[model samples]
Target: MKMSDVAKLANVSPATVSRVLSNPDLVSKETREKVMEVINKVNYKPHIVARQFRTKETKIILVVVPDITSAFFSRVLRGIEHVAVKNGYQVILGDTENDTDRELEYINLLLQKQADGMVLLTARQDKEKLEEIAEHFPMVLACEYMDGSNVPTVSIDNISSARKVTEHLIQQGHTKIAHITGPINVVLGRDRLRGFQQAMMSHDLEIDSAYIQEGDFTFESGYNQMLKLLALEAPPTAVFAFNDEMGMGAIKAVKDSNLLVPNDVAIVGFDNIKMASVIEPNLTTIDQPKYEIGKKAMELLLNLINGEALQKKRFVMKDELIVRESSELVKNMP
Candidate 1:
């Protein structure tokens, strides 16, 4: 159906209908609702390419994620999709596949005016580069963020969440704790590591240098790191991993070595992925608002795109610590 037909049926001018469809905020609230009702009733679809030629907007959003296979990013993507669809927009998935070059290629799409806006799930770009991009396009960061840039971000307090989980293990009287970290180059890895370290120091616990293992946020890396830590003269009584994938890997390694969970060695993880709750012994992990972060990031980006001012650029979400059998001692059972 044509937009003119929609305008006639809705009792508004074609220009008003165009404004309602392309940028709802520009129209009056009553007019927007009436136009949308007519739109839904007629199922009229605009020719996006023609619209783009006239408005310089594709009505498509570019969502860039570092890894496609990771469940953590997938959850965030779901949230982003929900908001995009409701706002008459399409989302293009840009999987970086952990390659910086590939990531930059997706960003360049924005520079080329293929996408109206962008939501960066993983912020690996240099501060200057990200600033340059944000200056020219509407952008928001999710999960990961820039170090000192003004780019809006939606994420939890990684350090506090990590420290709180570590403190849980310490409160249970487990010392000699080992840490399995994400790649130290990123903020997620660095903040989680600092949280673990700070928690250990707060309790006057001996921070074992040999117990720190760096993982690439993968199961294999977690398994391998756990093996290395197990080989130490005195292995840790508990292990904290930056993510659930690594935590599960550590559990497998411990079981392989004939060690009991929470008895021989307790395990804790961040990011309460689905597997975290389904494992043999449910994982004790931090529940980050992955879905909410994605939803908010898109909202912020849309506001920027619609020329609305954002009162707050940075949104720090809250996290909950879930305790389960993975980190619970049988003796301490109620």
Candidate 2:
């Protein structure tokens, strides 16, 4: 049934029906209930497809992630899907796979009115381009943030989370701790690296340049970076990978080298992904509320879509460290 039919049944103008749908709070409780009762009795469903032709809104939110294979993104996607489905909206996924050109293409699609809003997982795009796009549509930055801009974002305090992981390693008496990180250009990568540095400096320990290696937040990159560290003349006693994928990779690399984990070398990782606990040496890492981050971002986007005023621009989630066998060297002793 059309909204006009519902409006006629409820004896109200179609504008009132539109207001009730967009912002029920703007209408009185009695009017809102009366409209909803008629909506339910008639089972009226607006033709969103036709509405899009006139209003330029498809009621679809595009979620862009660097990679879909990573379990971290999977949880985040779940959160977004949960909220989107609840609010009578649809979500579309765009996997950029760390390709800047692909990212730009997806953004261009959104700009062309194929989608109503976007949630970006990377910060590699041009700042000016993003600012220009923000003028016309609502956008939320998830898992990463733009440099030198106040974009509405949903993410954990990466710097603090990374510092906590580093401190955990230090407290275990690992002076020569190594770091395996994602691309340095990404905000999370840089913040995590800075946290590692800050933790080392706080203890009056020199941040050894040799112990630092860069990865692309992939398992293979983690494995190769670990190999490089192990080949060094004086390999570090402990290692910290930015994510669980790399952390698992580090464990596999150490195992292949015939080294005993936590005994010969300790390892820690971030993002308590599902596989973290399943691995032989359970990983000690920071637990980011990945699903909650996704859910909150969608909820905020819905509020914006409904014309609700936002009290804050950024939503910062909390992170926790889950200590397991991987980083617990002494605790693992026989």
- Candidate 2's TM-score reads 0.86
Q: What is the TM-score of each candidate against the true structure?
A: 0.88, 0.86
- lDDT score for residue 235 of model 2: 94
User: Positional deviation of 79 in candidate 2, in angstroms?
Assistant: 1.0
Model 1 alpha-carbon drift over 4 Å, by segment: 1-45, 330-334
In model 2, what is the error at residue 204, expressed in angstroms?
Answer: 1.2
Clashes of each: 0, 0
> What lDDT score is found at residue 329 in candidate 1?
57
Cα-based lDDT at residue 198, candidate 2: 92
lDDT values for all models: 0.91, 0.89
**Tens digit of lDDT per residue, candidate 1, span 1-334?**
8998999999999999989876788999999999999999988898978988998888899999999999888789989999999998899999998888898999999999999999998888888988888977999999998766788989998989999999999888787889999999988999999999999999999888898999999999999999999999888889999899999999999899998887788999999999999997789999998889989998999999999988987899999999999888546422
